[model samples]
Each structure stands twice: as C-alpha cells, then as structure tokens.
Target: MTDTSIEPSADAPAQLSTLDRFLPVWIGAAMLIGIVLGKAIPDLDETLDAIKIDTVSLPIAIGLLAMMYPVLAKVKYTRIGESLDRRSLVMSLVLNWLIGPALMFALAWILLPDLPEYRTGLIIVGLARCIAMVLIWNDLACGSRELAAVLVAINSLFQIVAYSILGYFYLELLPEWLGLDSDGIDVTMWEIAKSVLIFLGIPLLAGFLTRTIGERAKGVEWYEERFLPRIGPVALYGLLFTIVILFALQGEQITEQPWDVARIAVPLLIYFALMWFGSYFAGLKMGFPYERNTSIAFTAAGNNFELAIAVSIGVFGVTSGQALAGVVGPLIEVPVLVALVYVSLWAKRRYYDTDGVRPRS
Candidate 1:
C-alpha cells in the first residue's frame, strides 16, 4: 500500500503548476463562455434541458469523482496513519461545522434578511464547503497534500450528516427561535440525504475505488503520474459544464433579479475572507509550518458547491431560493480561490524562508 502521508516533491508534474498560475483567467473565461453560450444558443439550452440522468446523476457525480482522484492519489496512503494529528483534525472540524456555518448564518442574516430569496441563497452557499476546488488550490499553494486528502474525505462524510442536521437547525429550528413560524415549510431531511448520497457519496466512492484499483495495479507513482493529471482537467470541465447548464436553466431568474447576484456574492466574500484568515492565523498560532498552514487555510476557505447544489435542490426544491444560492457559489468561489492561491504563494515568501519552501516554478 502506498503511504498517503508522504508529500509529493515540489518538482513533480503530478500537480498543475502552469494551470494554477492562470486558473483565475481560465475559470473566468469558462464562466463567460458558459453564460454567453447558454444565452445565445437556443438549441444548446434545449438540449441540456432535454437530457436528464437522475438515476445515475452522471455529470456532477462523474465530475466530482474525477476531481478527487488527483487529490487522493497524492495521499501517500502508506504514511496516512502517521499523519493523523488529532489537534489539526479537531480544529478543522470545529471550524468548518461550527465556526464557519455560524459565521455565515450571522453574516447572511445581517446582510440579506431584507431580501428573502437572496437570504436563502446565501444560506446554501454558506453551508457548503468546497470539496473539489480546495484540493487543487492546496496543491497549488504547496500545502500538505496528505492532510488535504484526509480533510476532503472527512468533510465529504461529515457534509452529509452535518448538512442535514445543521440545515434543519438553521433553516427551521433557528427560525422558530427567532419567533418565526416554519409551519408550511416542505423541506425534507431524506431528500437532503438522497442528494448527498447521489452527488457526494457516489462520486467519492468511485474516486476511492478507482484510486485503490489503480494503486493495486500500477503502483502509486504510476497512478499519480500517469492517470491523475490527465483526468484532472476533465473534472473541472465537468463542473463548469454542469454550472453552465444550471445557470442556463435559470437564466431568466438571473436576468430578472440582478440584485440577487450581488446578494449571493456578499456573504460568500465574507465567508471566504473569514475562513482563509481564520485557518491561516489559527495554524500559525498552533506552530504549524508554512506548507501545512497554507493547506489548512485553503481547505477551510473553499466551499464544495457540487454537494451544496445537490443538497440545496434536494432540501429547498429545484427552483427554491436556496438552490439558486447554491448555484451562485461557484460564480464567486472560482475567481476568489484562484486569487487566494497567489496570495498564499506570496505569503510563503514573506513568512517562510525561501530556501526550501518556494512554490513550484
């Protein structure tokens, strides 16, 4: 078995060094193209609309599965047991489930209560952490890939349980606490579980299985070198395509409610800043090195929208305000995360000695 705790060498091409530099531009272009194509091409919209694959939920599931492989392959599974630091793990869990979500709820309440639709949207965005994109960013920031893999796996598992529990408490129980009635609310917990299972669980399982099989057959080095990089872009493309289709379907809503976009962006911006600094500063205080600190920060900062969207649609109905909020998460997340990667790299130079800690050139 490959030791998952071993960090990949900075020189390894297994990670996307070149693309990381220009990721923001690429993501922006992809979003623009998606929007333009979604608006201009009637047939394309109709085609995406016509094709439905609920049983397998292929696009999102496949995209997620594909995205995780590269990250998982770097796990150094052989050393994974040695890398289990309880302090780091507990801190991350408390921050993600407790601190992160609570902060998001408070921010959304303050910033968006006047706009119900956007308030709900902000909630969805706040609840979901970035499972796929953070790993990529962590790699770019020269963070501990092993820790990232473990966190991603753990987060994926917790998201299903925590999403349902926290979502209920926030959307329902908290409303009651605030003296609001949730009498006619039609949200169902089972639906949330189902969506998580289809979108997150299946894809995660597929990625794990694929990695396991690949490692067994080709060895960890071969799987990481030969397979993961080739498939990494596919995951991003898949995610992009799914988002385009989603936005295309809801183009009219976006067109009509221009302010809704701004509303969604606000809490997201706040959440991103909070998580980034919270993790970075916390890690620094905990005496972590730059590499591990960067990983912790980025991992905490990112939101996993695939799972978020899936759960939002499940809990709030496809056209519900919450689902719309989930849709807008990527709009802000992609660009912001890319920018942070650059910021993290810069931080590395200013704080850590450049002798051995420089990001891959």
Candidate 2:
C-alpha cells in the first residue's frame, strides 16, 4: 500500500462538502430535534429503552455500529503496521491512561465539589477512553488514518483490561486516599469487555472484511475513489442519528436541568481543550508531523461515551444524576470536537509545512 500518511492532501475544511463543513450546525439541529421529540412524546425514553443488547439499548448499539463502520472502512489497515511509530503509540497510551483520567478526576472534584454523583460520572467518562467517535474526528481533521486505527485498536484492547481496575481506583480508592467520601462502584469487567467487543469489535471486523473483499474484487483506485465516497455520507448520517437518539433519551433531563448540564459541561470543555491542545503541543515538541500529531490529539481528547453511559446506567439507575452526567458527555463532546476539527485545520496551516512537519522555530 502506498503511504499517504505523512500529509493531509488538502486542508480539511476546503475539501469537505457544504454538509460536512456545517457539521456543528447539523449536530445542533439533531440535538434540538431529539430534545423536542423526547419532551413531546410521553414515555419516549422508556420506549427507546425497551430493547436491549446486553447493557446498551439496541437502537444505540445499531447507531454506534453504523457510525463506526464507514469510518473504520476508510482506514488503510494494511499500512498501519508499516507506519507505526513507537513514540506516537507511547504518547497515546500515556495520554489515554494516565494523564486523561487524572485530569478528569481533578476537574470533576474542583468544579463539581458538591455533586458527588456527577463527579463520579465524569471520572467514569475519563476511564472509558475513546473508541467510537475519535475515528470520525480524526478523519475530519485529515489526520493519519492508519495511526488512528492502530491507536483505537490499542485503546479497545487496553480498556477491556483496564476499565474495571481504573474504575475501582478512581471511584473508590483514590477518593479514600485523599480523605474524601465516595461510594464503591461495582463494574463488571465482562460487561465492559462485552461492550467493547460489540461496539468496536463487530464494526472493526466488518470494516476490515469490507476493505479486504472490496479491494480483492476491485482495484484500490476503484475502491478508494468510487466505493468509499458512496459510503462516506453514511458516517455522517449515522453520527447524526446517534446524536439524535442520545439526546432524545436524555432530553428531559438535559432541558429540565439546564444549570446542572452547564455545570457538567464546563469541566468537560476544559478537559477537551486541555487534552487536545496539550497532546498536540506535546507531539509538536516531540517533532511529530501534523498527521500523527492530529491522531494523537483527537484520540487523547475523545472518550467512549457509549461505555461510560452504559456503566453509569448499569451502576446507578437510569434516572440517577450519574447517568445524566454520562449522557452529558456526548452532548458537550460533539460540538466541541467538531470545532476542534476546524481548529486542527487552522493549526495545520499556521504551524505545519507543506509536508506536514512543524518547522523548528
């Protein structure tokens, strides 16, 4: 496979169609629609929540699968090994595991000191890491496709082992060590692992198979130019669909408790800015090219809202404040990450050379 991982072909914003360029608007509209639908229809949440695939709602699982498949299919899987950089991988691991969770823990405590449930929910969000939408954000920012694939793969496998342990530490032990009050959280490792396998594993396998079969039947050019574009729009549709469903399920809570949602959103905004900018600059300091650096930034910044919400609802009741906090995760993340995609493009122009390397000042 040819290595086009060094530089983005064109500035992302310029290359995007009108629909994609106005992604934030579309997302906002979806959120509003979901909220209206949820509020207007009695028992909408209960109805949506009726069907379940393990711990997650079946509609959500379907949306997640749809949201993930096209993006993963766009990855050039064959080149992931060839383009792998140990340094980038190490940085991603540290950001996702150590710095990311600790930052959320601190922010939650600092910002929402009086609200323990919300704090715990934010901490859970941090531990979950990004498996789903990072691919979309990374692709939108014109980041390295193969590197995003590799990092996401690493995160999925690592979360299966680390989520429960980290949950215990963050929720129970860390607070105790700090002489603070916290309730012990019971998180099943198998449930979390099952979620990862379903949400990520199924789509990943499908994406890989699609590419393998598609490429074998048709040439790479035909697949990349023709088939990929035809399917590309599905990703946006899936994303919009997921957002609508998520907001619909939690709409009453969000609209009713606007102030609380704002409170939850503040620390989340801080977390995304800190993670994305911090990771980007760290990669720049390490002399990484823009493509790899973007992958690092987005992968670090995004969290697995699906896993966090599932864990929260399973641990706390569906209407618990903790669950509301978990729902707020994507509500804040969507618009923010969409903005960062543009910001990444801006940084690319101002900071990076044509070859995607930031010149040494």
Best by TM-score: 2
Candidate 1 CA-lDDT value: 0.66
The C-alpha TM-scores of every prediction are: 0.83, 0.96
Superposition error at 229 for model 2 (Å): 0.5
Q: Which stretches of candidate 2 lie over 4 Å from their true place?
A: 1-11, 358-360
Model 1 ranges with Cα > 4 A deviation? 1-17, 41-50, 55-57, 180-229, 355-361
lDDT measured at residue 92 in model 2 versus the true structure, 0 to 100? 94
